[model samples]
Target chain A: MVKCGLEIHQQLATKKLFCECNSELSEEILYKFERVLRPTQSELGEIDRAALEESLKKRRFIYEVTPNSCLVEADEEPPHELNREALEIALKIALMLHAKIVDEIHVMRKIVIDGSNTSGFQRTALIAVDGYIDTFFGRVRIPTICLEEEAARKIEEKDGGVVYRLDRLGIPLVEISTSPDMKNGEQVKEVAERI
Target chain B: MDTLRSKHIYKVKILSPNMEVEPGDLVEVKTKKGTFRGILMPKHEFSDENIIVLKLDNGYNIGLIPEEIKCIKKGIRRKKKSLYKFEKKDLPQISIISTGGTIASYIDYKTGAVHPALTAEDLIFSAPEIEEEANIKAFVLFNILSEDMNPLYWIQLARKIKDELKESHGVVIPHGTDTMSYTSAALSFMFSKLSGPVILVGAQRSSDRPSSDAYMNLISAVRVAKSDLGEVAVVMHATTSDDHCFIHRGTRVRKMHTSRRDAFKSVNSQPLGEVRGNKVIFYEGYRKVEEDVELYDKLDEKVSLIYYYPGMSGELMTRMLEGMDGAIIMGTGLGHISNEMIPLLKDFIRDGGVVGMSSQCIHGRVNLNVYSTGRKLKKIGVIPLEDMLPEVAYVKLMWLLGNFERDEVIKLLPQNLRGEISARRMIIW
Candidate 1:
C-alpha cells in the first residue's frame, strides 16, 4: 500500500516574476538592509494557526541585495505586472499535458513567515488543474500546476538570525504537483519526467 | 401632504405624473415590457432622467421606462443588522468626520444601493474595535470625491476641524484618496497649529470587499487621533499587507501608487510615526500637541498647476497661466523648462503672476543653482520649493495669495511653513 506523489519545481529562464529585474545573480553586493517579517491573515481575515505560531517567534531577517534585485525584492515597491514569458511557459506546459487552464488566473499571495520573502508572502498563480500523466505502472493524476516566485536564497544563519539574498527572491518557478496515485518511487520519477 | 412622496429626487415623466413614488417606496409597476414589483431605488446622478430604477427582492437592480406605477407601501422599513452599540465609557473622546468616500459606505439591504455612512455609529459599526478605544462623535462635511476637492471646501473643512478640536480629543477625517494628499496638504498649510491630531484616512478598496483596508485604516486612524501628535497627517496602510498603518505628515506625504493599499508614502521624508495594534508609536521630527490652535483658513482659488513638458509652446504656457494669481510648474530635473518658455514665465511673473518651481521627480529637492536654465528661472522670480511636492506647492501658493499681500507672499513662498519645505533632503525612491 505504497502511495506516492511528485512535486517538481523548475525555474523559468525569464525576468523576475513581478519586476524587470534580471534572473541572473551578481558577484558584488549592491546593498544590505535589515527588516522584520510577520505573518499576515488570509483574505477571509482568518490567520493560519501555523503562521500565527511562527510570527510569535519574532525573527529579524537581513537581506543582502544584489543587482539582480530592485525595489520590488526589497519590499519597497509594489509589484508590477506578472512576467509574460514565465506565464507562457507554464501555459505551454499545461496545454501539452492536456490540463484545463483556469478561466481566470488568480495570482494569490501565500503567507510565508520564514523571512525568505521580503514581502512576507510568496506570490503564486494556478495555471491549470485536473490533468493526468500515464506512467508504465499506473495513471498519475496531475492535480495542479502553479507559477510561483522563488524564495530568497538563504546565505547563512548568525546569532539565531537568518540572512537571505534578494537575487533569487523573485525568479519565476513552475511547480507541477501530482495526486497520490503512483505506487512506487520509479513510477513517480517516470511521471515527473512526462510532466 | 404625504411625508415621503415629495422627498424623492426622481421626477420621471413616464411614471404616472399624479403618482409620485419616492425612493425606498415598495411599488408594483406595470410597463409595456412586464409587471415589476420592487423597492424604488434612489436616483443616481448618472442614470437617465426619464427612467426609474428598482431593486428586486433578488438583490439585483433594474432600470425601466415605466408606463404606470402603484405604491404598495409608503416606505420600506429596513431591518438593521447587528451593529456595534456604543456604551458610555471614559475613553478618549474622538470625532469622526465623514467626507463621503468608499471608506464610509454600506449596502442598503432594502434598495441594494450603497449609501455613504455619515455618522460615528456607522464608523464604529464597521470597525467595532474603536468602540472600546474611543468615545466617538461624528458629522459629515460634504459628499464629494476628493478629485472634486477645491480650495473653498478646504477653508470650510479647516474651520470645521478647528471647531471639532476644541471639544474632541482629536478629529478623524475619512476622505477620498484621489486627492486626499492635496486636501491634507491644503489643511496642513491652512491650520498653522492644532490642539490635537487631525488624521485623514481613506481606503484603496471599498468597504464591501473582504480585503478592503477600510475598517483597519479607520481603527488605526482612531488610535492615531488619540495619540500625542498635533499635525494634520494621513494614516494609511504602511505596507500592502494588513500589518500596520503609517502616520504620514500632511505636508510630506504623497499618493505614490494609484490603488495599492500602501499608496500614500512620506516622500522626501520619513513618516512621522506608525500605528501598530493598540500601541501608537511616534518617531522623531514631528510636532506635538500645542496649547492653543492657530487658525488661518483663507485660500486663493485662482491658482493653477501646470506640468512643463519638452517643446511646450509659449502660447500654451501663457494660456495656462493667463488668469491664475499663482502657478506651480512641475518642471524637469533641477526644475527647468525650455529656455524659450522661461521668458514667458518671466512675463507671467512680471504681470502679477507668482510662479513657483517644483520638480516632477517627486522625491528630491528642487535645486535651481546647479544648471544655467534653473538660474535663469530663479532670476525670473520662479520660487524653488525644495523637496515640496508639486501639488503641495500649488496649494501652498494658493494659501499664501489668500492670506498675505503680494510682497509678503513673494517673501514667504520658499520659507518653511507647516513643514512643507524640509530643510534637508533625503535619498528616497
Candidate 2:
C-alpha cells in the first residue's frame, strides 16, 4: 500500500504574526547587518539533526532591512504578542474544516539556519488538529494546522554570503497537513481543492 | 564563577535567596507570558535594564522582561571538554601566526562568546585536518582586531616572519578581514625578496559555526605555504563553495565585502595562483623562490589617504596636508579632484608636500592626461598612480617616505614597487 501526506503553507493577509510590522514588501532598503548563527544543544542534550546540518555550512547571513522592519525582524528585540487578526483567520479556517481547536497555544521553535529567517529558528504554533474533510471518493483527515511566520525573501547570493529582504519576514503563514486517504492523484487534487 | 552583570539586580534580589545562579548555568524561569527553560546567559555590557537573556534549548536566544518573572529554578549543569588529540607526523613545517580574527577563534560554550585560539594545539583541535598536511608550529604575536593594526605591528610582523622562515618552509598569518589587505601590502614592501610564501588568511565566520570557512582557508594557506610560491599573498575562498582558494598578490588584493567568505578579491590584476586539493597552480609570471631573502622593515606612518567625494570642503584637505609626510588622493573618474581644492593642493605641493593620486574606481589605470580637470590637477604636481589601489598607494607612500628623500618619493610613487602596479591589465573574470 502507498501512503501519501500533504503539507500546505498559505500566507495570511494581516500584520506579521509576531510583531506590529505591516505585512508588505518594500523596495527601498534602509539598513543592513551581518550575523553568524551557531547550533545549540537541545533539551535532550543533543542538537537537532537539521540545525546541526545547517551549522556545518558556516555561511554569513546579511539582512537588508527597510523602515517597515521592527527590532523583532532584526533579532535585536524580542517578539511581541501574536497577531490577533491572524489568529482569528486561522480559527475561521479551522472551524470551516471542523477541526478541534486547542485550549492553549504554545509557540515552538523549528531550527532553520539557511539565512532565510533573521532568527535562526522559525516560530510555529499548533492551532487545531484532528478534523475530516469529505471528498468525492473518500474522507481526508486533517492531522494538524499551524500558524507561523514567513521567512525573508532571498534577493541574491554573492561574495560567500546570502542577502535577504526583511519586508517579507515575519508575515503570518498558515500550514495545513493532511493524512494519506486518497487512492489516486485525482483524489488528492480533489482533497486539496476542497480545503 | 561567572557572575550575571546585568542591571536587573533588583529583580534578582526579589527571587528566592536559597537559589544561586550564574551565567551559563541551566535554569528555568517563569514569566507572565509563559515558562522559559534554557541556559542563563550573561548580560550584554550595554544592554538595558529590566530584561534577562537566555539561550533556549533550541539554540535560539531570547530576552525576558523582569516584570513578568514569577520564579526561577536552577537545573542540572553540564561542562563541556575538548576531545582533540594530535599525533605528530613527518611533513612539511608551516608556522601559523595568530593575529586575532574569526579564523583563529572558536565560540566558548559557557558564555556564547568567541575567544582567540592562541596555541597551535588550539588550532589543531579546531581543524585537525591541518596535522595531516603539515607539522604545525604556532605563535600568538598579539591579539587585537585588524582595524587596530598599525605600521609598527607590520614592522614587528615582518621581522617575525623573517625569523620564522629559517626553520619553516612557509609562514601563515591568520588575520582579521577588515585590514588584511593593508597588512598584506605593507608586508609585500617590507619583504623585498622571500625564501618562501608568506600567506595571510582570514575567515568570514567563527570556527564554532559548522559552516565556517576557517578550516578550508587554513588548509589552503598551509598548502600554499608548502608549495613553490615565493611571494606574499592572501589565500581565501575564491567562491562560495569549498572547492579551492585563490592566491592574490599581497599588494593587489582588497576586502570588497563586509561579510562574506570570498570578500577578498584581486583588484586590477589576476591572482598569483590557486590552491586546489593539495596542490598549488601558479599563474603566468609568478614569482619564484630565491636562496637569499631581503627584508625592509621601515615605514613612516605620517601619511593620510583622502577619498574625494562631492560637496567636500577644502578645509578637510588642508587639515590632511598639515604635518603629513605624504598623501594619496582617491579621486573620481580618471583621478580628478574638485576644482575648489586644486589651488590649495598646488600650494601644498609647493611647500614641499609630496602627494600622489589614485582612482577610487578600484579598477582601470589612472590617466591624468585624459580630461582638462586631470591635466589641471597634474600641473599642480599630483602624481598619478597607475592601476594601483588606494590602500596600496597609501602604504607604498609610507614606505617610500621612510626610505627615500622628498624628491625621491615623488619619483618612486608612480613606479611599480613589489607588483603594486601591473604592466598590462588582463581581463579575467
Candidate 3:
C-alpha cells in the first residue's frame, strides 16, 4: 500500500511570463554570461530555508543566451509586466477546478539557487486554493494551484558548475498540487489522468 | 454635567435619570427614528452639547441626540500590544521634527480619519526602541498634509532645523511621503553647510498598523541621524521586507511608486547608505559633517514648472511662461519641445524669463547636443540641466532665482550644486 500525491506542471501557450520574449527554444547561442548568486531576505525578514541550503554549496552558474533573450534574461534589467494571456489561462484552469480564487494575486519570490534562476529566486503567485475532484476510489483534494515562471533548462556541466540556457527561464508554468490522500498508486494515476 | 467627570463635555440634562455613561462604554440608544447600538465616544470640545458621537459597526462614526438609551455596559477591552521595546541609555542627541504624515498620525475615531495625533514625546515613546537609538527631542511644526506643503513652509522648517541642530547632534524629520522629495531638495539647496545630518523620513502606512513601515523607518532614521554625515537624506525601506532602510540623497531621490514601502528611490545615483540591524552602512559617495550651516533659505515663489505636451497651443505655452520670473520645462526625450514652441521660448528668454530644460523621462541626463530640436532649444538660450530630476531642477531654479541675480541664475542652472547632477554617464541603475 502506498500513499500518493500528484504535482502537475503544465506549460502555458503564451509569451514568457514576464518579459515579451517568445516561447520558442533555440539551440543557437548568441551570447553567454556567468553569475554568482546570493540569497535575499524574505518578507518575514529571514532567509528562506531552502535558499540557505543552496547558498551553502557556494557554486557559480553560466547561462547561454538565445536571440529571444534580452537584458531581463541576463538580470541586467527588471522584469516587465506579467503576460495577461498567461494569467487568463491560469485563471480559467482554476475556475474549472472549482477552486476558490484569491481576491488579490500577490507575486512572491521563492528562492532557488541551483543555477536555474539568475536572481536566485523564482517568481510565483497563488491563483486558487481548496478544491477537490471526485474519483471512484475517493475524493482527491487540490490544496493549491499556482502560476510561476519555469526554471532555466539545464545543459552540460563545466568545471563543477551547471550551465543553463536562457530560452526557458521566463516561460509561464502552472502548478497543480494535490493532497497525499490517495491510498494507492492506481488512484493517484487516475486523479492525474482525469485532472 | 458632572464637573468631576471631566470627560463629559455634554450637559446632564441630555442623559436619562440615574444613568452613568462613559466613553468606551457599549450602549443601545433609541430615538424617534429608530434604535442604534454602538460604543460611546468622547465628546470633542467643539461638538454641540446635545449631540453624542458613536462609532458604528461599519467603521463609521455617527452623531445623534437620542430620545432613550439602555445598557451602559462595558465593551470588549483591547490591550494595545507594544511592537518593540528597549531600555533607555546614553545616546547621541537627535531632534525629530514631525510635519504630519502617516508616521506620527493616528486614526481620529471621531471622524473615522487619520489625524496628526502624537506630540514629540508621544512619537518617541510609540516605539520605545527609537529612544534607545537616540536621545530624541521631538517637535511637531505643523499637522498639514504633504500636498499643502509650500516653499514658505520649507523656509520655516529650515529655520527650525538650524535652531535644533545647534543643540542636537542631528535632526530627523517625519514628513508626508507625497512631495517629500521636493521638500528634501528644497532643504538641501537652502543649507550649504551643516553641523550634522538632516534626515527626512515618512511611512506609507499608519503607525497603528501592525505592518506599518513607520517603526522600522523611525528607528533607522534615528540611527542614521546619529551618523557622521552632514547632508540632507531621505530614509525609507530598502525592500518591502522589514530588513533595513536605504539612505537616499535629498537631491537625487524620488518617490517612484505610489504606496510601496520602498517607494523612495535614488533616481540616477545609488543611495548614500543603508541601516541594518545595529549597523549604519555607508556607501561610496556621501558627504561628511561640516562646521556649521550656511543657510540660504530664500525662494522666489514666481518660478513655475511647465511640462510640454504634444499639440500644445502657442497661447498655452505663452500663458505658462508669462508673468513668471523663470520657468523649468519638462521636455520630451533629449529635452525637446515642438519646433513651434522653441520660437516662443526664445522670445521668453529674450525678455529675461530664464528657462531651464529638464527631461520628462525621469532617468538619464538631458543631452541637447544629440538632437536637432534640442540644439535649437540650446541656441535659443534654454539651459539644459544634466541628469537632474525634473522636480529637483524645478526646486533648484526657485532657490537660485531667490538667492542670486538674473545672470547668476542662468549661469548656475547648468552647473551642479548639492549633488543634483551626476558627472559621469552610467549604464546601470
Best by lDDT: 1
Error of 3 at B100 (Å): 0.6
Structure candidate 1, residue pairs in collision: none
Two-chain DockQ for model 1: 0.03
Error in Å for residue A150 of model 3: 28
Residue B47's lDDT in candidate 3? 53
Interface RMSD, candidates in the order listed: 11.4, 9.3, 15.1
lDDT of 1 by residue, B230-312 (tens): 89999999985566899999998898887677899998888889988778898897888998899888889899899988878
Any residue pairs clashing in model 3, and if so which? Answer: B1-B12
TM-score of 3: 0.62
DockQ for each numbered candidate: 0.03, 0.08, 0.03
lDDT of 3 by residue, A74-112 (tens): 654557878999999999888888887654454545657
| Strongest candidate by TM-score | 2
- Compute the interface RMSD for candidate 1: 11.4
> Tens digit of lDDT per residue, candidate 3, span B1-429?
011123435563555444776666678877553566777766644456766766555333456677766656764432342222233467778888888777767533222223463456445533555665777777778776788899999999999999989988999999989989999999999999999999999987665333456777888888889999989999998875456899999999999876667889999898999998779999896889998888998999888899889999999999988889899999998798999998898898899889998989989889899989988988999999999999998999999999999999988998988899988867887
Candidate 3, which segments miss by more than 4 Å at Cα?
Answer: A1-195, B1-25, B31-37, B41-89, B107-113
Write down the worst ten-residue block by lDDT for model 2 chain B: B1-10
Indicate the docking level reached by candidate 3.
incorrect
